[model samples]
Target: MSNHKDEVEFPKMSFLLMAVTTGFVGGILWSLIGYLCYYFNYSTIEPNILLEPFTVGTWRESWIGIILTIILYGIISIGVALVYYILLKKLNTMWVGIGYGFVLFLVVFLILNPIFPSMKPFLQNDINTLIAAACVYILYGLFIGYSISYEHNEIKYFKEKELKR
Candidate 1:
């Protein structure tokens, strides 16, 4: 049996496919939603503009940029999902997801903004843009965080039930 210092330990599944899949789905969904918000002028930041640091040669300004950006979002989210599964999977609370998303907002906007020349400081963006981005991030976090924790709890419940049998 596994042991957690603060929470009940769960049985290990043979694979962690749920986390990976949730990452891609959450990533693509948030990127598209954010882009739509930008398209409708509610947000000033282009969803793909976060990729400015790794893209080059006018590519970021091209149609391919959007596709690549979405793919990158999926890739990055996989790691982020894995992190949530590892660190916060046992928390059993949705607030953790909201807090996690807010943390991500801070990391991306305040900490990582300097890495992307096109990104403005957190205080510089208008309220709408900030709200739009925050909502998107929070939604993404809720998706990943809630799903993982729910699954972990479900598995733990089943395992305990089986043990009692």
Candidate 2:
């Protein structure tokens, strides 16, 4: 029997592009969920919370600020995707995604947010907002994790099909 690595076979460019596009989609989904929660008063958390430093009086004055926040979050999401991709070889992607989302919640909410004085009040809110934010992150995590799994399978199948030809 030959030992072959269950490899993630794809061009680096394809992987990078996929990660970025997935991140973009995740960001859009996150923003939509955030706004919905805001509308319902389920949570006061906003997508632009970390962007407080970059904006002046309001986010409306500078569209660039909004765009920048999205882009930044997208980049961060790539890190989440990377973790999923790395662990996909060994474990279930869905569970890994959940763990990834939880870790992200801990890192951002518990660790990073407290570092910024501007974010203090937002983080200090009651438990309901935390639950809402956790839900949002878990959903985003599931998207990235499943997406990577699906994309990887597509690429692998194409390669196998080509070999058969």
- The number of the candidate with the highest TM-score is 1
Q: Per-residue alpha-carbon lDDT of model 1 for 55-159, expressed as tens digits?
A: 667787578888888888888899999999889999999999988998998899998889878777889999999998898899889888998899989988989
Global CA lDDT of candidate 1, please? 0.87
Across 53-151, the per-residue lDDT of candidate 2 in tens digits comes to 655677532666666766777777766677667776234368776777777777778777865555555447777788888888888877887777778
Native-structure RMSD, model 1: 7.4
Taken over the whole model, the C-alpha lDDT of each candidate is 0.87, 0.71
lDDT of candidate model 2 versus the reference: 0.71
Error of 1 at 155 (Å): 0.5
lDDT of 1 at 43: 93
Each prediction's TM-score versus the true structure: 0.87, 0.73
